[model samples]
Target chain A: MSITAILINAFALVCLIYGFYRDRDKAVKSLKKAAKSLFGILPTILIIIIIIGLMLGFVPPAEISRFVGEQSGILGVLLVGAVGAVLHIPALIAFPLAASMLESGATVMAVAAFITTLTMIGIVTLPMEIKILGKKFALLRNGLSFIIAIIIAILIGVIL
Target chain B: MLLAGMFIVALILVSIYPDRRGAVFNTSMDYLTEMAFILPAVMVLMGLFSVYIPEETVVKHLGKASGSKGFFLAILFGTLPTGPLYVAFPMASTLIKKGARISNIVVFLSAWACIKIPQEMVELQFLGPEFMLARLSLTIIFVGLMGFVIEWMMKRTNGVIDG
Candidate 1:
C-alpha cells in the first residue's frame, strides 16, 4: 500500500480502538454504519472504476489534451466546470477520476475546475436544497459556487 | 441501474476492442486497488463521525456562534467527514431557523460540500500534496469570500427567500 493508504488505515484503526475504549456500544455502532455505507457506495464505486477504465482505454491522450489539456484554454475549463456542476458523482470517487484525467493529458486548470464544481455545486440536488433551505439560498449558493469554482480553478492554474 | 448498464457497456466495449482490453483492465485494477486500500478506512471514519457528532450538536454550537467565531465554527463544523451536502441541507435550514447568520450558513454549506477531511485525504493521495494544498488553500479563501457575497445578495434582496 502507498503511504497515503497506510496512514489513512492507521488513523482509522487508531480511532476505532479509541472509540471502543471510550464506548463499546458506539464503536460497534460505528462499525455497523461503516459496513452499511461501504456497501451503499459500492455500486457507485464500481461504476466509476469502469468509466475510468473505458475512458483511459478508448480515449487517446491527444484527444483528451485537445479538449481539456493546457492548450484547451479557458473554454475547456468552463466546459468541465459546467459538467461538474451537473454530474452527481461522490466527491471521493471524483479525485481518482480527476487524477486519471490529469494523467491522460487534462490540464491542472481543467481538473481543478472539474473537482471544485463537482463537489461544490449540485444541480441534480437543487430541488431538494430549495425545498429544505429556501429557494433564494439554494440558488444563490449554487450560482455563486459555480463562479467561485471557476475562480479557484483559474487561481490554481496560475499558482500551480 | 447505472452500475449494471456500465458493466454491460464495459464488457461489450472490451470484447469488441480486444486490443484495448489490456489497457482497460490494467487501469481499472489500479483504481480498484487504490480504492480498496482506502475506502473502508474512509468509511469507518465517516461512520464514527456520523454517530459521535450528531446534527443536534452542530446546530447547538453553530446557532450560538456569531461574527468571526461563527465563521470559524461554520468552517470547522463543515469540514467534519459525515455525509454528502444534501445531508447538510436540513441542518443548515435548522441553523437558519435558529437565526444563524446567512454568511455562516453559506460558508457552512460550501465547506460541507467540498472541504471535507476524508475528501482532502483522497485528493492528497491522488493529486499529491502540492496540488491538494494549493487547491485547498485557494478554496478556503474563495469560499470564505463567497459566504459574504451571497449573504450580501440575500440581504439586498430580502423577503425573496421563502421559508
Candidate 2:
C-alpha cells in the first residue's frame, strides 16, 4: 500500500477506537449494525465489482473509443456528456477506461464530458440517492451537476 | 449455509412466481459475478481505511473552512479516497457532527465518486494525457459548482441537517 493509504487506515483506526473507548455501549451497537449491513451487502457489492471488471477486460476499448472520439464541437460534447450521465461506472474504472478510449483515438472533449457525467450524474444510483437524500435535493443536485459538467466540458473543449 | 438458504428461496420463488423470480435470480447471479472481480481490491481498501485513518484527521483537513479553494482541495482529496459511496454518507454525517458544512461534504463525496486524479493517471497511461487532463479539469469544475448549488438549494429548502 502507498504511504497515503497507510496513513488513512491508521486514521480510521484511531477514530473507531476512540468511538469505542468513549462509549462502549454505543460503540457496540454501531459495530453490530455495521457488521449486519456489511455482511448482508458486501458480498453483493463485491460480486458486482468483479463482474464489471471482467466485462471491462473483455470488451474492446477500441469500440468505445471510436464512438466517443467524434469531436463535432458542441453537439459531440453534449452527446458524449449525456451518454456518461445515463451510464454509471466506477470512477477508478472510468479513468482507465477513459484513458483506453483516448489511446484508441477518442476525442479529449468527449472523454472529459464522459468522465464529468460519469461522476456527477448518478443515473444508476438515482433511486438510491433519492431514497436517502430526498427527491428535491437529489433532483436539484444531479441536475445542477450535469449542467455544470457540460459547461466544464465545453470549457475544456475550448481551453484544452 | 447462507448460499443454501438463498438457493432454497430461489427454488420456491421460481416455482411460485416464475418470471419475476427468474429475473431476480439472473440479476443476482450477474451481480455476484461482478462483485467477485472488484471485491478483493475494495475489501483491502476498506480494511485499510477502517484501520488507518482517524475520522478526526479527515474532518480536520476537510472541514468547511477548506472554502471554495478548500472545496476544490476536498474534491481532489476525496477522489483518491478509496471507499464505497455509502461509506462517505455516514462519514459526512460525522463531519457534520464535527462542524463540517453539508455543502462541503456533498462536494467531497461527489468529487470522490467522480473526479479521482490518481486513478485517472493510471488510465492516462492507457488513454492519453490530454483526455485525462480534460476529464479531470471538467470534473473539478463540476464538483466545485455542485458544492455551491447544493448550498443554495439547502438554504432555500431549509434542508440543512442540524448537526
DockQ of each: 0.81, 0.14
Error of 1 at A154 (Å): 0.8
All candidates: TM-score: 0.96, 0.58
Instruction: Give me the overall lDDT of model 2.
Output: 0.60
On the 0 to 100 scale, the lDDT of residue B57 in model 1 is 91
For model 2, residues A72-135, the per-residue Cα lDDT tens digits are: 5567677888888887655555654454445456677777778777766778777776666656
- After the best TM-score superposition of candidate 2, give how far the Cα of residue B121 lies from its true spot, in angstroms: 3.4
For candidate 1, the per-residue lDDT at B80 reads 86
**Clashes in model 1: which pairs?**
none
Candidate 2 chain B: 10-residue stretch with minimal lDDT: B34-43
- Model 1 has a clash total of 0
Candidate whose DockQ is highest: 1
TM-score for model 1? 0.96
